[model samples]
Target: MALYKTIGAFLLFLGTVSGYANPGACSGTCVNTHDPSIIRRSDGTYFRFSTGGKIAVHTAPDITGPWTYKGAALPAGSSIDLGGNQDLWAPEVALVGNTYYLYYSVSKFGVQDSAIGVATSSSLDVGTWKDLGSTGIRSSSGKPYNAIDPNLINADGTYYITFGSFWKDIHQVAMKNPPKAVASGSSAVQVAFDPVKTDEEGAFVFKHGSYYYLFFSKGKCCGYDTSRPAAGEEYKILVCRSTSATGGYKDKSGKACTNGGGTVVLESHGNVYGPGGQGVYDDPVHGPVSIRSRKTIWLIMLIIFALQILYYHYVNTKIGFADGQKQFGWNTINFSSGWPVV
Candidate 1:
């Protein structure tokens, strides 16, 4: 009987350590963590980048972390100045061979003068990031037409980038190295899509199970008032899938993405408003998963829950002993009864 109890206790401890759902499964207060780029390191840690232009890391022995933030990967002074008030936004990160590349947009809202820049970091941790400078792939007028928001992917040893906001349409350019943008003369194909709203942006591409998934966000971002409906608005993450890398993109309803085809993957459920700017991470343990933030009370609740679970397990393991204990009389408990008191 002693050996049996010991084995059962060991199994319970393992369950507490290993069992968890994907972080992306979180609903409710999950808000506007837009334009997210995710990567799983060789050591099983998952790092993410977003429009904040500051990269964040989430380390878990597993994919579902009570994910703790380890400070900004890009320091406060690392951003490039594109004149007045134009800050960094919509960061896209990709890993090729031994190097990691970060592409981001530098612009202010409603401004045509914006440019995209690239930064490189071998480690995702804080202060290890280095800016590689602008891609030089400016707009047709040589000005920033919000030309900075970039999504990068590697296919068969070639690097391809897709970018652009609601100027005309999204544009795709091929790259040979980290900061070198595909030359203007190279065949840059416009992703066939018409914007329903000028605030539409945050484009990402991923190849999964023979289908290439193109994800984008539509509606206003970062604007508290100008962007409408508050939390549960029309601004949400949408997806289109194609068999080819750059063609045949269509919504689940069979509408062509070239003609505004999109299907919502993540949207506001209640107070969680306008969750856009998303990137997919192929997690080591949970497979492909997404990490986005929300603006609401619910996210606070989620954070509290996550923190509580982590603290209880890693910091307060003694408290967990009472969980499996059986309650006897009023205000009394007994672990000797074992679990599921039959």
Candidate 2:
């Protein structure tokens, strides 16, 4: 899941973006998004929390959508008793101040008996979320990190949370109580690792200009109905960079994402197969400004925060997830070679 924060007038507009052209191919309900997490409420709507029925909820005034099915942000699921708990995994929404939390991810797929929960909302609608189960951020089985793919970020003013998967992959912590669990006596700091296939997980971090990019997801995500991991080796999308949002990440040859480096920003091209669950933000605009219409590139998502999008999830070897569906993609970044490509 990917939460976002970096808006002080967009921090010099998230530094750089140019020639945008394609964040296209989006339509109603945006197709079965898993691990998705989007936010945009101050009255323009746009919700969209993802990963299965318990945390589903979708809405959209524009982000290039017609998205409307707003239903479960825990409609009676996840009291945190664990074991699938009505199916939830990676939601991660954020709006810290007028309250909107929504963290999520209990666990059941390779079993670490994980945790990581939270739910709140002042008005995201869909019955106004409020689960509040656990945010202790747990994991088992020799835990080195495997709570699940969460990703909250605020940096400079603190608030971090970069979860994990695949044991010993990505970790980070420093969100206390009202900030939402895992802080008292802190202990999570890995930040990004692969050490030759510890097989990363969806980790997103973004501060833009002074660095802190990070963006994970690597190797075998999902079963593909039994076997399928060796043509670019399943899931893709990788990145690294850091000036210290908790660790010293690196890439672009400086190499040090915990010694496994990282660089490919989206992989398995052509009809987009296995393209990681990435993220980035900057979509604000409150009034008048237009983009000259290709039917209004959906008004560049509201046209202001640069809409530097990086949304992800792919697989369409003719409708993949082994035909169970897992789509919902995007791209509008171009950070001018300082990294981010799409």
Clashes of each: 13, 0
Q: What value does the lDDT take at residue 177 in candidate 2?
A: 44
Top candidate by lDDT: 2
Q: What TM value does model 1 have?
A: 0.66
Give each model a TM-score. Answer: 0.66, 0.33
lDDT of 2: 0.75
Per-residue alpha-carbon lDDT of candidate 2 for residues 1-342, written as tens digits (9 for 90 to 100): 011233322332543243223336678877778667777787787777888888888888866688888689788888988788788877888888778788888898888888888888888788878787877888888878888778888886778788898777899888874677777888888977877679888898987778889888889877776788778888888888988888998988998988789988777766667877767766543222456632554354334324367777676666656524877777666454567765
Worst 10 residues of 2 by lDDT: 1-10
- Which residue pairs show backbone clashes in model 2? none
The regions of model 1 sitting more than 4 angstroms off are 1-34, 53-63, 76-81, 84-86, 140-145, 195-199, 225-227, 230-233, 288-342
Go through the candidates in order and give the C-alpha RMSD of each one to the true structure: 14.8, 19.5
